[model samples]
Target: MKPLQTWVPVPENSDFTIYNLPFGIFSVAGDAPRAGIAIGDQIIDLAVLADAGLIAPEKDYFTQPTLNRFIGLGKKVTNEVRLQVQRLLIDEDSELKKNPRFLVPQSEATMHLPIKIGDYTDFYSSLEHATNVGKMFRDPENALLPNWKHIPVGYHGRASSVVVSGTPIHRPKGQVMPKGAASPVFKPTGRLDFELEMAFVVGRNSDLGESVPVSRAEEYIFGMVLFNDWSARDIQKWEYVPLGPFLGKSFASSMSPWIVTMEALEPFRVKGPDQDPEVLPYLRTEGPKNYDIDLSVGIRPQNGEEEVLCRSNFKYMYWNMAQQLAHHTINGCNICVGDVMASGTISGKDETSYGSMLELSWGGQKTIDLKNGATRTFIEDNDTITMRGSAKKGDVSIGFGEVSGKILPAK
Candidate 1:
C-alpha cells in the first residue's frame, strides 16, 4: 500500500509523516493554547479549521485548552476527525489546503501538555527490568516475585506532577538511608534517574464499579506518548518497603507533547511475549497486543553533546497494555478520561537495553562512559535526559516525538 501523501513537504525521515497525524496543544506568539495536529513541519490548528467550519462543525471541542474534551467524544468522533483530516491534507483542492492561515510552522509554536491528566498509573511490565532490580535488591535465585507473572504490578502516580516535554524538573528532595547508616537523612537526592517509558491516554470514561475488559481495551485508549518517569533511587530504596513509590516518584514525571493515535500504529502491531504459566482468562488477549516501536534514551551533560545511553523497544515488555488495563480495573475500579497509564521501564534482554540508570549502571556499582570523558552512575544536576520512540513498517512510519527534561538543583 502506498503511504498517504500530504501537500506539505515532509522530510522522508520526519516523524510527523502524512501517515501520522499526531495531536497536541500548541500556542503561537500572543495566542492561547488550542488543539492542533502535526503534519510534516507544520501544525494544523484544529481550532482554526473548526471555527471556519472545515471540521467538527457540529462541536467545538478543538477550542478547548487541552485534548480532554475532544477525546471524551469517544473514538467514533475522534477517528472520524482523524480520517477527515487525512483526506483534507491529501486533497490539494480542499479548502484547508487553500487556506494557509490554518497552518502554522511547528518551530513558531510552543507545545503544551496535550491532555489534562486526572489520574496516572505506572506499571512494571518489563520482565528484564524487574529481574535486574530484584537481583540487586533481593535474592538473585528468585529475582522475580512469585505474583509477577500472574499480574501486572502498578501504582498510582501523581497526575499533578506530570509535566510536558521541555519542562525542567528540580532534583527531588527526600529521606534517604546512606550505606551502613541506621537512620535516614532528608536532603536533595544524590541518585536521580530516568525511567524510559511509554504511556497511553484514556479517551472514554467508565462508570464507577464498572470494569474495562481486555477485549475492548483499545477502544478506550486514545493514543500514546514518550514518558520519562524520573526516579530518586536512594529515596526509593529507603522507602519502598511495605507500600509502593511515593515522594520518590511524585516530584516529577515528563511526557512528550504529541499523542500518536492507535490507528497510526496499527501497522506495527505484533504479538507480545509468551506468557509462561498462562495468564488468567481475564488477562488473555486474542489479537496483537504489542507494538514494534524502536525506543532510545540519550543524556546530554551541561555543556556536552548528547550521548545515546540506551537502546530498547516497546516490544520488550512482557505484559501488554490490554492486560495492564484489564488488571487495573478487575476490582471494579473506574477509569476516567485523560487518565495516563505508563509502561514502566521498557528494558530488553540485553544489558545495554536496560531502561533506568539503576539497571543500566547496576545500582551505581558501574559507570557508563560518555563522550565528554565523563562517567555517570546516576543522573547529575544540569544533565538532560531525552527519550524518543518510533514505529516503522513498510512505507508507514510514525513516532512519539520525544520527552526531555533538564535537572536543576533542588530549591
Candidate 2:
C-alpha cells in the first residue's frame, strides 16, 4: 500500500504518520483535558473540532475528558470519524488546514490517561516468559503447569492504580523471606523489575451470562497500548502460593498515553506462535491473530545515559488477544467498555530477548553491566525504565510512544 500523503510536514520516520491517527487526552496550560489525535509533532484537539462542527457535532463524546465515551459509540461511528479525520488531514484545500487554533504542539500539552478503566486483566500469554519463570522457581521438566496449555491464564489487576506515562512510581515495601530464614521481614523491594507487554482496550460492553465467541471478539476491541507491569520479585515470591498476585502488583502499573486503534494496526497483523497440545474449541481463532510489533526496553540510571536492555516482539505470544477475550467471557463474566487487558511479559528465546529484570538477570544470579561502569541485578532507586513499541511495513509505521517511569525511594 502506498503511503498516505498529508498537507502536514510529518518527518520521514515519524511514528505519528498519516497512516496512523492514535488517540489520547491532552490539556494545555490552563485548559481541561479533552480528546485529541496525534499527527506528526502536533495534536489535533478533537474537542475544538467537534465544537467547530467538523465531526460528531450532535454528540458530546468527543468533548469528554476520556475516550471511554467516544469508544462506547461503537466501531461504526469511531471508524467513520477516523476516516473523516484522515480525509480532512490530507486534503490541501480543506478548511481544517487553514485553522491553526485546533493544532497544539505536543511539547506544550500534558497527556492524561486516555480512558477511565473500569477493570484490568493481565494474561500470561507468552510461552517463553512463563516457561523461563517456571524453570527458575519450579522444576524444569514441568515448566508449564498442566492447565496452562488449555486455558488463557490471567489475574484481575487493580484499575485504580494504573497510571499514564511519565508517572513516577515509588518502591513498594512488603514482606520478604530471606535465604534460609524461618520468618520474613518487612522492607522495600530489593528486586524491582519491569515487564514489557502490550494491552488492548475494550470498546463494547458485554452483558452478564452472555458469552462473546472467538468469531466476534475482535469487534469489541478498541485499540492497543504499551503496558509496563512493574514487579517486586521478593514480595511476589513470598505471597503468591494459593491466591495470585496482590500487593506486589496492585501498587502501580504504567501505560502509554496514546491508544493505537486496531484498525490502524490491521495492516501489521501476523500469525502467532503455534499452540501445542491444541487449545479447546472456544479458544480457537482463525487468520492472523497476533500483531508483529517490535518491542524494546531501556534503563537510565540516576545520572547515566540510557542503555537498551532487551528486545522482544508481540508475535512471541502463545495466546492471542482474541483467544484471551473469548476465554475471559466464556464463564459469563461481564466486561465494560474501558476495560484493559494486557499480554503479560513478552519474552523470546534468547537472553537479550527477556522482558523483565528477573528473567534478564536470571533471578538476580547475574549482573547486567551498564555503560557507566555500573551494574545491576534489578532496578535501582532513581533509575528510569522506558518501554517502546512499533509496527512497520515498508514506508508506513505506527508506534505507541514510550511509557517511562522513574523509581523513587519508598515512602
lDDT of 1 by residue, 1-411 (tens): 676788889987899988899999999996889899999889998988888887883546887889998898888888888888899999989999899998999999999999999999999999999999989999899999999999999999999999999999999998999889899999999999999999999988988888899998888899999999999999998888889898999999999999999998898999888999899899998878999999999999999999899999998889999899889998999998999999999999998899999988999999999989999999999999999998888888887889999999999
TM-score (C-alpha) between model 2 and the true structure: 0.99
Give the clash count for model 1. Answer: 0
TM-scores of all models?
0.99, 0.99
In terms of lDDT, the poorest run of 10 residues in model 1 is 54-63
Model 2 residue 184 lDDT score:
97
TM-score of 1: 0.99
Candidate 2: residue 204 Cα off by (Å): 0.2
The 0-to-1 C-alpha lDDT of every candidate, in the order given, reads: 0.92, 0.92
Question: lDDT for model 1, on a 0 to 1 scale?
Answer: 0.92
What value of lDDT does candidate 2 attain over all alpha carbons? 0.92
